[model samples]
Every structure is written in C-alpha cells, then in structure tokens.
Target chain A: MDGNGVSGAARHAAFAPLDDGGRAEVVARRLSEAIALGLLGDGEQLPSEAELAAQLNVATVTLREALSALRSDGLVQTRRGRGGGSFARSPADASLERLRRTLRELTVHELREIGDQHRAIAGTAALLAAERAASEDLRTLDTLVDQLAGAGEPGDRRRADGRFHIELAAAGQSSRLTRQEIALQAEIGELLWMPSGEAVPHPDAVAEHREILAAVRLGDGQRARVATERHIGRGIDQLIDFHLRLARA
Target chain B: MVSDVRAEEMSAAAREVGTALDEVFAWLAELAGRFAAMHASSVAEQNQLRAADLSQLRASIFPRLTGNPRLLAGTGVIVADDVLADQPHWLEWWQHAQGGTELEFLEVDHDPASVGFYDYESAAWFVVPRDTGDRVVVGPYVDYSGTDEYMLTLAHPVSHDARFLGVAAADIRADAFEALLLRAIGAVGQPAVLANEAGRVIASNTPSKIAGSLVHEAEFAGSPVRVVLNQDAEVRDCAGLPWRIAALRG
Candidate 1:
C-alpha cells in the first residue's frame, strides 16, 4: 500500500512517535488496544524491549514500565532465557466484566465523540461505495449481512459487524477509510456487541446492513450515507444506554 | 507500424518483470525442496517431522533469507492439513514482526470454529500452487487476516514422490514490490499499467490507472493508442503467474 493510502497512513499513525508526559500509560493503552483487536495476535512475540522502544519512540525504561504493567494485567507474559520475550496473551474470551468497567469509566460525551468519528468514517465510506463498489464488493457486503443475521453468539456478531464496516470501507476503494474503520472497530466494536442483560439487537443490525447494501447497490449515495449514519447513530445510543444501565446496577 | 514497436517493447518489459518475479519463486522453490526432502527423510526413518523440527528449520533459514529486508517481510512453510503429527493444521512461519531486526513466529488461530481462525487452506496463495503444482504470486492486496499489511504472497508447492506436501511462501511488502514493478515498467518509457488476471492494477506509470483500480477492457477496445501486452503470450518464466502489461501508445 502506498504510504499516503489509508492502510499505510493508519499504520504510520499507529506506530508514530509519542510525546513525553504520561508516556508509559499511553504506550500501555495503545498496545492494549492492538492486542484486544487481534492486531497483535495471541501468543505472538513482541519486539525486543530496545527495538520496541525505538519503534514507539520512547525510552527503554518507559517501554519496560509499560510491558511490566501489561504483564501484571495478564495481557503479556515474559519467558526467561533464549526465545524468551514478551508475548501477547489474549484470553479465549474478552471479559465482559472488564468491558463493562471500561464502559463505565467513559463519560457520555466521550462515547458520543467516538460515535461521531465512526459516523464520519463509515458515512463517507458508504457514500463512496454507492458510486464505486463493484458487484463482488456488494456480494461480500451481502454475505456479511447474512453472517450477522445467523450469528448466535456475541463474538460471532461482533466479528460479522466489524467485518461489514471494514468491507464497506474497502468497497469505497479508500485504503485510508478501511484502516480508520478497522481502528474504530477495534476500539468500540466489541463493546457495542457486549453480551449484557439484553442481547445486542442483531435483527435490527441486520436490517440496517440490508438498507445500506441496498442503497449502495442502487447507487443511491445519499441514501447509503444516511442509512450508515443512522446505523451508527443507533449503536451509539444503545452504548450510552448500556453505560447508564450499568451505572444504575 | 510504430504501434508494433511499442507493443514489442512493452512485452519485453513485461518479460523482464516476469523474469524477476520467477527468480523470487525459484528461491521459494528451493526452500520448498528442502522442506519436502526433510519430510521425506523423516518418513523414511519412520518418524514424522514434528512441529519443533519445522520451527527449527525455519529459524535456521530465516536470518539468511531476510538479508534483503525490504523485499520480504517474512517467509515460511505451511504443510497440508492434517499432515503434521502434532496438529491438524500447522504453519511454521517466521517474520520480522515490524520490519525490525527481531524475527518472531507468526501466531494464528487454526481452529475452524474460531472467529479469528486463519483458514490458509482456502487462501489463493496456498490453493493455487498446491493444486497446480506450480509457483504462484497471489496478491498486491491487503492481508487483513494475517499481517494486516498490503503484500504480495509468492508461493511454491512442495512435493515428494509425486505426492503434494505443502507450500513454501513468502510475503513481500506491496510498496517495495510496487517500486520494483514501477522501475521495470518505467524502463519501457511508456504510459503503462500492470494488472493481474482480475484486471486490478498492480502498478501504473500513468495517474489515470492507479494501483488497485480495476480496468475495464472495453474502455480501451477501440482505442488505437492502447496496446494490451500479454494478451496471448505467456512469458516463459511467469508461466503460472497471470499478469499483463497494458501500455498506451504515447
């Protein structure tokens, strides 16, 4: 991918140099996101401390502090001796309780802000896709919607939903949009589909995907954008509602 | 008559690229040959090669193969499903995890039921060579499933005693590979686009034909300035690779 393209651009942003203050926490947060998102696969060896520090543009001491914190959190484990390095340790399931706690920590304003960013990216992707998408791209979108419809578990639903958005962005033929979509999906996709007291409204989600797909197939850019925004808008509302309900509990 | 000369030049340039890519495949074939030999010898000794043995083999060759870090992000061997005694599916792959100095084993879920499962068997890179018994270049597209990088996967089938065993594969970063392609196409000094069989542009000297954009053959059907090279010719070195160079008469 071209460096100016979205995927490359996103990668550049993902590993870009950071500022000094609270550096350890920032590094820890970013690495946490990458692991949870499978950007760093389970049991994958992390770069050496010095190499990682160089890549993240932080001091070796700060990188060590972040790695230690992740180790204590059970997200990373270090082996002693040769072939010994910090490895990502993703559990079989992303803990629902942990997700709930993270959600509870976020303010309504923060949730809304993230939603706005998603809408911007997804909406534009839909609009472009209506004009640019080929038959094969539409077929992929159709399959993802069906996958969402048939998904019986929260994990399956999350996977289907996240892939739909990413595929939609790819259909837009903007690697940049695809990369941003992946980042946003990694950040909030799991949360939106979190299996709580009430299961995520998959039938509604499937219907929304259908609407967006229809608009794209018909080359209705305006309708596609509107449907996409509505879909994301509803998800944001549901997340906010989930946060508030957890607060009450 | 002038168009004939341009067509000849375009074909020559395409062949040059074909030769370079074939050399990469030849290198992978050598690796595959080693893997096949190891598998065969282990079988002859009545002891199947274990995952550890494969991993050790990969680790041994990884450093030497990665001397040109810009051309390849990683390389490894993936055996046929259920071929390994230790696991149903196995990939003994290692990569420079971040284009950095450190090499690490690639971690992927092989479970069919898991959401994160990497179904390499279904992937073109594995399937094409495995079935055809030939080398193949699979992409200049995003690898969302594995490395999450846009890369070209070059692979060759490994076989022993007429039985297919696996594929020796390498991932080439798209940017670096594209630069190589552009250099080849640029040497022809013509406005040209190199596309895969799907008509997806791999690289183009002309801005109108951007990389990753699909080309409609009909759009240039009647244009006298357009010369679709490789329409009927299969460059010998790239016999199994389906790519073409479409050059415009500039």
Candidate 2:
C-alpha cells in the first residue's frame, strides 16, 4: 500500500517484495526456499507473525494460517509468547509414514542417487562406528540388535531394526555424521515403508541389521562396512527392480 | 550438505522451528497487555503521592515512630491491619478528630483485606510544619501505609531541572497486582509474580496453596532479581528461556 512496498528483512529474507503476489504466496515461496537451502538451519527461529505480516503486506490472520500449513507438514514449530518464533529442524518429519510419503515422491534415478550417497557416507560411518562407537553406544546397538532379532510382529521387528541402525548412526559419534545418517536412514526406511515400490527391503531388512552389528562387535571394521553397504545396496536393487516393472507395466 | 535430500530435510526442520516460535509470540503479547493495565493503575496512585508537598507528607503520612524523641517519637498511625481489625471505636476517633476533618485516602494502610477508597481530606487535614516552618496544607489523598505487606512501588523522583526534589511513589497491594497478573496468565496458567525493588514478594496469583512455607515469599525457579534498572515495563524473551514480563520499578 505504501511505495512499491516495504522491503523489510522479512521481505528480503522471507517474502516476495516486487511481485506483490499477496501474503500466502510470498510466505509459501519463502518457507519452501528456506527449507530447501537450509537457510533456517535446524533449531533456528523463523520471523514472528507481526514481522511476517508487515513484510508481506498481509494481515496477522493470513500469516498465522500460512504457519499452520508449515506446522502440518512438520516443517515448523510454534511456541507461545514472549520469544515465540518458528524453529528449523532437518527431517523434522521423522515419522515412519512421512518418510514413506517423501520417498514415494522420488523418481528411480533419485532413489539410486540417494542410495549411492548413503553408501559412501555410511561406509565411512561403519568404519568410524567400529573404532569410535563407545562401550555404552555399542551396548545400545547390541541391545537393539537383540530386540530386532527377537521381535514378534513384522511391524515391531521393522521398527526395532530401524532403531538398531539409528543406534549405529548415533554410535558413529559425531553430531554431523549422526544427523546425516539419520536422514539417510529415513530415506532407506521410506523406500521400504512404501511396500509397492521396493520389495527387496521387505525380505531381509531385519537380518541385515544383525549382520552389520555382528561384524562391528567383532572389531571387524571392513566386514561391518561391507555388510552395511550390502544391506543398503539390496534395498536400492529392489527399488530399481520395482521401477523397471512399473515402466514395463 | 548442499545435496537435494539435505535441502529437503533442512526445510522440514526450519518449518518445525518456525511454528513453535509463533506460539511463543502469542503468549508474550497477552503479558504486555496485563502490565499495561498495571501501569495505568499504578500511575493513578502515584499522582496522589505527588499532590501533597514534601513537608506535609513527611509529618502526617511518613512511616512515623512511636513516642520518645530519642526514638521515632510518634504513635505510628498507619493502615496496619492490627489496628484496623478493631476499628469503629478507633475509627470513631477519625469520625471525631479536630471537630472531624478526616483526610480521605485508600484503606490499605487501614485495611489489608480492603480494596481501596478515595479519602483526600484525611491526608490534607493532618500536615505539620516542615523544617521551613511552612504550614500551608497540601493535598495527596492516597496512602501507601499498611495495605497488604506485599506491594509494588513505582518511584518517579519529583525533579527540578534535572535535580532531585522529592519522589512520586505508587504502591499497589499484593491482591491488586495479582488480579493484573491473573489476567496475563489467562486460562493456561503459568506461574507469575511481581517482585519489588528488594526482591520481596510483591504479588502472586499462582494457585498452589502453599500451606506452610509460602507465607509471604513467592515460589520461583531461582532467587528473585532485586536490581532496579531504567527500562520500560515490557514483555521480553529470555533467549529460549522463560517469557518474562518485567515492569520497571519506575
């Protein structure tokens, strides 16, 4: 309403100033970009409603509604007053179902890329986890492995197995590495969670976790690395197989 | 880190954080409104403190001592609950003092359990000569004598060209301050308090019926802050810590 518009911090950092595409579009674009670029950073705060509303030339109600969508998507978190602001987190939507939904949206090529990237990173992690995983951390992995091996239900086994690998990632003993492994694990689990896409992960995902732990426990870094890679590679092969079948059909 | 999956994962994290911050903002605004109401009420009380001249108030309303010039030397006439509890006969003295010209004022000094009253004459009718020997009776009808022991004092020093003259002080009792704080805490009650300059319990509306130990002090996570700084009464974020509502002691 005032001179071409107010290009405040929220405008430049958060909203679209020139196009004046209205508030929702501006906020959506900003939020999407912020997520994509990791600009918000995990645990960093987003601007306040009044700040966003003023920048977008929108009302407080509009800003709040936009935030609600982000909340539903598991992208942002809201707290009440004084220092109320949104926080950013990597893979904030860590739920098994969300991982499935996100993986379902991926192309076969993207799945291959994800698999390759994870193999490279996790190969390094398995090597480190063997050398670096503390006694307590290793015990946590061993206990979960025992649970994974002993679990009754298919769903329970799958969850425990996932937890065992997650423990392995934590055992790697670096926050950055652990965080990255967690994302990769989410990707791997998602590829399997959507049963229609990948059939390989469904067959022996539980057993694969055991092999990796067994190798790591014996202080055999090389075997641990290979077993971890083999398990993940098997999941990738299934995803590729399904993709090919889909094309043929 | 700059990869596609990394990008997508980071995006979700940002969104989660953003949502939580919004909720916190809503909570802070409500607190500001409550302090504003307290500010208005305190301001009105302070004006009454300003109406009377320094000398007149010193002799009549200042916390005087009982007897013996070697001591405070004046049977303290304040709103002490001990004395007000047995009024009517005692208050009948006011109804009949100096052919009956009781200066009007709030009953806090008179009654800790009472709300407030406007007794201007009760204050004006009782001024003694100052060191200057000036006896022109001035008028500050409000009294901050004995109300609830817990009190909020906002002291604005009456100044002269950047010089200190006297002070304009507003005293809100613990009960009145509690009403203001309750409005701020709202339905989802967060423990809240208004501490005085000395960190003494000025007020609290918390529902925890402190059966024994809670006699006067408020319950807090740590020792209360007692320092007075020059700042506006406002709600502020404590860096992901507690959302604090700090009202300046004025």
Which candidate number has the best TM-score?
1
Superposition error at A80 for model 1 (Å): 62
The runs of at least 3 residues in candidate 2 whose Cα sits more than 4 Å from the true structure, single-residue gaps closed, are A1-105, A152-155, A194-198, A201-203, B1-250
lDDT of each: 0.74, 0.43
Error of 2 at B107 (Å): 47
Interface RMSD of 1: 2.8
Please give me the DockQ of candidate 2 compared with the native complex: 0.00
lDDT by residue (A1-249, candidate 2, tens digit) is 121232343235444342455556446545644442333445666667787677667777877877787777566788778877776443433353343334345678987898898787777677666755544556768778678667654345555666666556555543345566666665566445442222343336657777787777776889999998888777677656444432332
Model 2 residue B190 distance off true place after TM-score fit, in angstroms? 54
* Docking level of model 2: incorrect
Give the DockQ (2 decimals) of all models: 0.11, 0.00
TM-score, cand. 2 vs. native: 0.30
Please provide, for model 2 over B1-250, each residue's C-alpha lDDT reduced to its tens digit, 9 standing for 90 to 100. 3234333433333333233323222322332233233334445566322222212333323322111112111121222111122231111110112222332343223332332332321332221111121112111111222221222222221222332222222332324434434443332133434333222222333544210111223335433322222123323211212222222211
TM-score of every candidate: 0.71, 0.30
